[model samples]
Structure formats: structure tokens, C-alpha cells
Target: MSDAVQTLTIVIPLQVKPRGGRKAMVRPGVLALERRQDVTLIKAVARAFRWRRMLESGRFATINELAAAEKINASYVSRVLRLTLLAPDIVEAILDGRQAPGLDLPRLLAGFPLAWEKQRASLSPA
Candidate 1:
């Protein structure tokens, strides 16, 4: 054999982005290999609507009572209840696993514009 050496190199194009308070590697024009659905966000949104319906139906006299029934903190329940005010399209995107990459439960729960139009604008990925 000749006293020669050969080298091979490989490169991957990826971007680091913040996803739900965590950093994740993202490749351009590539779909995730696994489910993109955010289970925590979906669960929170579902709970918000369910709580809203319960309150509307007089099933719960107050948030505190609802919180007690759910065994969740009252403050947490209140924060989650705000999800009921999200724009319908946003909710649909979330449920469909097509929400903006940056959108997450913490961002949603932290609060968003009350106006639907503003919400869409504000919640979009930068």
C-alpha cells in the first residue's frame, strides 16, 4: 500500500433556537422526525377551555373553588384561564402542531396581547 492518507469531511447545516425555554437544533426546510405537538401547551389550553365552560355553566362558583377542585394553584389556574382569550387561529395552530417555533406554554401563560390581531402579530417567531 502507498504511504498516503485520505480524509473525509461532512458538514450539517443547523441553527440553534429556543424552544419552550430550551435550546434545540433546527435544520432549514426540514420537518421534525418526531411529533411537533407540544403536549404541555395542548393540555394547558384544553384545561383553560374546560375551566371556562365549567365556570360558564355554573359548575364552579369561583376560581379558587375551581383551583381546589383541580388541585392546582389558584394563581396557576388564573394564568391558565387566560388562554381562553387567545385568538381562535392561534388555538387552532397550537392544536394542529403548527404554532410558531418560539411559542410555548411559558410564553403563552406569561400573557399576550388581549386583542386577537395584536396577539397574532406578537406571538409570531422573530
Candidate 2:
């Protein structure tokens, strides 16, 4: 065979979607090996647990006190603290990056059902 130059072309299908203020390249119908962790969501959940610990330890007398110590708005602190009431499975999913794709801090802070079953139903993909 005569020597000749050969060119190869490759094509990939994907979509760019925003996740927690950052763009993510998602391949159509492909399962990702890596976890899609959302830093903002994780941080908020962690903060909520930590604040709850402080209150339980008697270090903070009230949400206002914790808010003052953290130098954030009391209402915001209270909202974040409500995360402690989340269903264990939901919290696990959030920590493991397995939460519903549309779930975010804003929707969470908006409030959820106090009942664990209702929370699962409310937060699940519709």
C-alpha cells in the first residue's frame, strides 16, 4: 500500500447545564462515575449540623445568638438550622451527591414538610 496521510474525526453529544452557579457538561444517556457533589449544598448542610451541635452543647442560647456569633442574619441561620429536620436518607443523598438533580439550597431553604414521609414525597423528582 502507498503511504498516505490519514485523518480521524470524533464526535460526542453533550449538554451544558448550570449546577450551583457552575456549568456542567452532561453527556446524553450516560451515567457519570464521579459524584456530582454540590459544594454550596454540602456547606449549608454542614453548617446547619454544626449550629445544631452548638445549641445542643449549650454554647448558643438561641438562633439569634448563633447568628450573632456567625455574623449572619438570624432568619438565615434559622432556615439553615431547619436542615437538621431533614430525613436521614435525604441527608445521606445530599452528602453522597445522590440528591435529585433539581434539588438546591434555595428550594431546601424555602421549607419542607416536617413529616419525614412528606419530605421524601415533596423533595422527590416530580
Candidate 3:
């Protein structure tokens, strides 16, 4: 060993803890709010489909034509037209009506087939 003393330097590394759960968990209240919003959205979608059918059927050509096709009074069609006052996206779909998978027009119409059939049966008296 040399008479002169040797100096040694020791480095200690610092350990860092990971930050825990920064994001807040979704509460039940938040989930309920989301579900309510979805229900409103679906109802609006159904109304849009109904309006689209009316516009595409060419019944809008005249009050008389519309009344004849819908078998409803002319003034009734005019009143129902008020639904167009809804959002533009809905109005556009109604005007440019396209049938798609999720947007099943037939299923929607079929939902009230019994009511329609009843009206038809009444009209065709024996």
C-alpha cells in the first residue's frame, strides 16, 4: 500500500415513487347523466326518421296530395311540418333520407304497423 491515502467517492441513486391514479373515477351520478343524455338522443333520432319519410314520399307536392297519401287532413300535414323546426341535422336527414343498417326505416315503420293496419281495415268497410 502507498503511504499517501486514496480518496473514494460513492454515489447513491435517488428512487422516485410513481404518481398514483391521477384521473378521477367515474361516479354513478355521472353514469346516470350519460344514460339520460343517450335516451334523449335516441328519441330525437326516431323523430328525424319519421320526418324524413314524410318529405321523401312526394306527398309534400301539395296539401291535397299529402292529405291523400297520409290519409290525414291537409291541415294536419301542415301542423306536422312544424317538426322541421328541430335541429338542422335532423331536418337534413329527413329531406335527404337514406336507409342504413342502424337507421332501419322498416323497423321503425313496423313498430306501428298494427295502428296503420287498423286504420286501413276501418277504411275498407265490408
Which 10 consecutive residues of model 1 have the lowest summed lDDT? 28-37
lDDT (10s digit) by residue, model 2, range 1-126: 979989899998887867569988888653352356667999999999999999999999999999999999999999999999999999988887778888999999999999999999988545
* Span of ten consecutive residues with least summed lDDT in model 3: 98-107
Ranked by lDDT, the better of candidates 1 and 3 is: 1
lDDT of 1 by residue, 26-112 (tens): 896544522577899999999999999999999999999999998989999999999999999999888878888879999998889
Candidate no. 1 TM-score: 0.72
Which residue ranges in model 3 land beyond 4 Å of their true spot?
A: 1-60, 88-126
Q: Which regions of candidate 2 deviate over 4 angstroms?
A: 1-35
Q: How much is 62 displaced in model 1, in angstroms?
A: 0.4
Candidate ranking under lDDT, highest first, comes to 1, 2, 3
- How well does candidate 3 match the true structure, expressed as C-alpha RMSD? 20.2
Estimate the TM-score of every prediction: 0.72, 0.72, 0.28
Error of 3 at 12 (Å): 50
Q: Is candidate 2 or candidate 3 better by lDDT?
A: 2
Clashing pairs in 3: 52-94
Ranking by TM-score: 2, 1, 3
